[model samples]
Target: MPLTKGRLLLAALIACALSSCQTADKPPQPRFTSTSKDAGSATTTKVATSRYFIEFRSRYALSYGHTYVVFGKLDKNGNMISPEVAGLAPASHDPSQYVVGHFIPVPASTGWTDGDLEEQYRSASWRVLLSEAEYRDVVAFIRKQQAVSKTWEATVNNCNAWTGEIARHMGYKTPGIWLRPQQFITQLRQMNTTG
Candidate 1:
């Protein structure tokens, strides 16, 4: 028997669920970049300092997608070292929790959920270098957020919101959280880069 429209849709959803958080496409190159400037001394000499960085990233996923942050200290050669990841998502791996989240809130898990390390799935990213003080503050704030954030809802509170909080903490303007992960990350980069 030929499959009906409803059957096809069901099959698609099931396939998406099974393949969620997995992708085959190569990771997109970093599309946005920002740097922090150090002030010169009264003697007209500039001091060198180590730079840390926070990267707001988006990746492909089952539904609209996912957004998260990767942050760490940068080496003298400007490479990330021991990057840390954080994001919010349904606590349960069961697909039902994600489905229920669309209509109501579900328990959330913050910090290093799946799809974080798979570079191929990354859709967008914004990297901002920070001062030592700023890096400490941002890391502390992320830890506090992870401790307090308890729930997830698709429309009200989700991955975008999680990253938005971090962006705001870093003094960057944020876009609407309702956008797809890729769009949200792009807008966030554009907004801060221009102003």
Candidate 2:
């Protein structure tokens, strides 16, 4: 017997349903399972990833017998920001626009002269792994520090003080006063042992 239009349409619908009529947007879900020790039962959970690591550098070397200048003896903010000496400074070098933005040419003399090392300084680096929420908190803490350090002075609020603030914000202990560069780096390493 010949089939009616309704019967033909029903047959097509059934065929499509059994074939590949499912929407592509909703593919499949991934599951992770764990078994219990006592009850012999299992549990499935969805795995997620939302953690990352950020590295902050705290570097310094022994110099002038006083404190390591975090970078080099002459790589302070004043010198780096305004390195305008003839040979020691980079003619009209703005340290922020130096070779790598952070690296300021090591001055020739202890003060400022014509022919400095023009090389980068040595430092210690610390890496911290944090969650998304933690990253935001840490960055905000750093910004606050930068704002406060805008009026930093060599005699009082020096480079060591600046790095110390950042380290302290990240849950590390810093010295109260007159912190040396190498010593501060040592403290950072000790605290970031797990990270």
Candidate 3:
């Protein structure tokens, strides 16, 4: 039997759900590329009072969207210096990995993923300042999480859950994992910011 319009729409939705973190646009160059000037200044005296921060972020993607964390030190002038990103997604750009991820665990990547830098894709963000001690602890936790993160399953081990673990480590309350990335990030900000 020939497929109907409704069937076609349902199939499209299913495909989108399976290919969760894929983006249609070609990945853009990162905004914070190191320069020769920066490389030459590596031996400068360390600032006595630097601010560190972790920004929980959500961005648009092919599926429900993505959530991640950007963290690093900031100068007294509030300029970022060598920020790092971490998130969880299927290891391969191949759609099959995302498809299988919905059923069985698929290999996952815990470092920077697509849409981390495109400002236009950002939906929500919550940035929290950290003391040097807190920053060290959080960075260590993120690195350890990256080292151990092995697989991705849409419902069980998706991006939201990964970020939630980081937020919990920082002593912030996280919304439930089932929420869309944008909603989860927005609620996270509201829940943690209010006294």
User: What is the TM-score (0 to 1) of candidate 3?
Assistant: 0.74
lDDT of 2 by residue, 1-195 (tens): 356887887676555433421222111122212111111221232112223333333322222111221121112221222222110112234443322212222221122222122323323333344456665675666545544433323334444555566556666566643444444444545544422
Candidate 2 error regions (>4 Å): 1-51, 60-120, 191-195
- Give the TM-scores of the predictions, in the order they appear: 0.77, 0.40, 0.74
Model 1 lDDT tens row, 98-163 = 988875789999888778868878888877777888889999999999999999987678899889
lDDT of 2 at 144: 58
Arrange candidates by lDDT, descending: 1, 3, 2
Our model 1 lands, by Cα RMSD against the true structure, at 8.0
- Please report the TM-score between candidate 2 and the true structure: 0.40
**Which is the better candidate, 1 or 3, if ranked by TM-score?**
1
- lDDT for every model? 0.77, 0.35, 0.74
Clashing pairs in 1: none
Q: How many steric clashes does model 3 contain?
A: 0
71-94, model 3: which lDDT tens digit per residue? 898878766688899999999999
Clashing pairs in 2: 59-123, 59-124, 87-114, 88-114, 88-115, 108-116
RMSD, one per candidate, in order:
8.0, 28.0, 9.9
